[model samples]
Target: MSEFTSMAFGSAWGVKDWDESSIAPIIAREVQNSWRVRGMGDFAVGARECGSATGMLEKWKVLREDEIQKLEDVKWIGYVGVRDATTTSMAVGDTSQPTTRPWQQMIELRYGFHPEVWGKGFGTEAAKAIMGWCGKYIGAERFIAEIEIENLGSGRVLSKMGFEEIEKEKEVIWGMEGTKEWKIWVGR
Candidate 1:
């Protein structure tokens, strides 16, 4: 976990171990927001969508003690949260459904910051730090992110991080029709 210490806000974020109680709320929040914005039915729908898309249904479907343990046990996976130093608001990133493809690891980088912190470079900094961690500690040869095509802000973030647009497809998993998703990849 010391590898995560050098990340932006990593020292202040704090935590070496995760349990169901600690991780559920974060997963719940991400699911709730994903459902609301993408019009997915709810957390369950979000879970199913992630399962179908990435096959790591167990990780995104629900929060449980075993899931936390599973995540902790993955030598190639890393998860982290970003927090405001003064306000204590947090954002999550690090894991998504495992990619169905064998050559690449499918991951989602989700970020949530207080409105006050928006437009700052904090998210980008945190993202870059995470990417570095992935490359150094996780031995990740490549990473993938799926974002709504309309999400220009997120697109900018990915572009700044050197993720290239690889493909786009219509996805109906989140109870939304004609949802265009951009599949971006980071690595050689």
Candidate 2:
């Protein structure tokens, strides 16, 4: 359990241990946001088309098991919820969900935080702990991320993690479809 508190909010936030039970909220949040689900790289056209994409529940069931057994998979997945330092409740503006590239590859990272917690440093803290765990346990030597052109906030978090853009590579983001290219970042 990495203790990640927000200096900006004067409140505590940390990456709670990964658990099989955490799947529900992660799934619930994914279902709640169509855009977030699309970024998952699972559905057709390389992104989720709708909230009701076929086999989502089934897919998530497998994902839950995968998270539990991430080390055996090609890409390692870790999940944690930001919680109130005092109460340990999920209700208190604990809205960041970190996304990563497929476990088969370089273990890229992405994150989304509730708007309320933006700028309070929660995202960066969660990201550091997530990346740290990946580096230490999974032997991930590099962290790659592709941010949408408009997602500057996510870009900032990548920067905070010491990830820098690969301006000239022209490499397409894996699984993302059709000409809507995203910018790439790499952290060593």
Candidate 3:
């Protein structure tokens, strides 16, 4: 893992380091309530269908280990996290998968924060900071976020960061819960 620094958020917010043990529970909880929110609940439901974090992590670990081996050759992506100065909670971005064209990379903004933090502009702040990290740290030229069509909040967040809608598609990966795809290009 690489070193993470604190980011400014009107107050002070630092980025936390993500390890398997520390991130597991956070992902589990996030999956549990993902569908309860208006535009996000369906995602949660899809997670449920896929067996939640337990199943997802099993696959994720393998991919991460392989990606780590090739990190030197692969481009640096971005970091995902929440901050409050005293304590920072966040996840690192993963770009190992080939979700788009050969040159295009994907960054999964996994396990952001408690729903209570929603509508507080924290999402926007964190996203912008992460994008900056992608540019400075990961050297990423572009990134993609696949969100459910109904996920208006996330759509708004992406828009706030200057992510424009490039395309929409139906996906059946999350327990067959159809997904709306959105591609966000960040960086040059």
Candidate 4:
């Protein structure tokens, strides 16, 4: 865990192994923000079902079990992250690509942080660290993201990290229909 943490931590924040105690704060923060739920739908594992701590923990355990599934089914390889007043989660996983590009491995990257830390650069820091780990451990060659059009903050973070916009389309975000901007971050 220390080796992994060293790879994802910086001066202000760092990724930590999942702790059940931390789930409460995350759940408390998330259930109150529909945008957070919608923005993080794909990578959150159980955003819709996370209205309660027990439910969220149950879903997380299932995700942990499913973590061992075939690569194609892998939707989240993530870490729980903490900074002074911030709690975040980061994930990278194999995402579905167009049938026309069956051979292209589109690894998707995403992060969710408590609103208290919004605009504080924790998102960028955590994303940088998680991406660093994914590059080293998963050997991901390319990464993609589907962000809500309203989430300019996340888009800005991606821009800072070199993710370029590729497409825009309407999609279900956290069980609600909305426009999503797709972007890709390529490894150099």
Return the TM-score for each candidate structure.
Answer: 0.41, 0.40, 0.42, 0.43
Note the Cα lDDT for every prediction shown.
0.42, 0.41, 0.40, 0.45
Which candidate has the top score in TM-score? 4
Per-residue lDDT tens digits for candidate 3, residues 39-97, read 12111101111234454212221122243343442222222431111111112232333
Clashes of each: 0, 4, 3, 0
Evaluated against the true structure, the overall lDDT of model 4 is 0.45
Error of 1 at 68 (Å): 25
Candidate that scores best on lDDT: 4
Clashing pairs in 1: none
Candidate 2: pairs in clash: 38-48, 74-103, 75-103, 99-110
Ranking by TM-score: 4, 3, 1, 2
- RMSD of each candidate relative to the true structure: 17.7, 18.2, 18.6, 16.7
Better of 1 and 3 by lDDT: 1
Off by over 4 Å in 2: 1-105, 168-170, 175-188
TM-score of 1: 0.41
- Decreasing lDDT order of the candidates: 4, 1, 2, 3
Could you give candidate 2's per-residue lDDT for residues 1-188 as a string of tens digits? Answer: 13112222112334445677877789566545533422222121111112344632223222222444333322212232211111111112333422234432344454554454456565676667655555555555555555554556666776776776653344333323211222323342
Task: Give RMSD (Å) of candidate 4 vs. truth.
Answer: 16.7
* Candidate 1 per-residue lDDT over residues 1-188, each given as its tens digit: 44333231223346458799998998788666544432321111112224344444234332343643343422222232311111111122313442233332433444433333334554566566555655565454555443445455556766887776643233211222222233344455
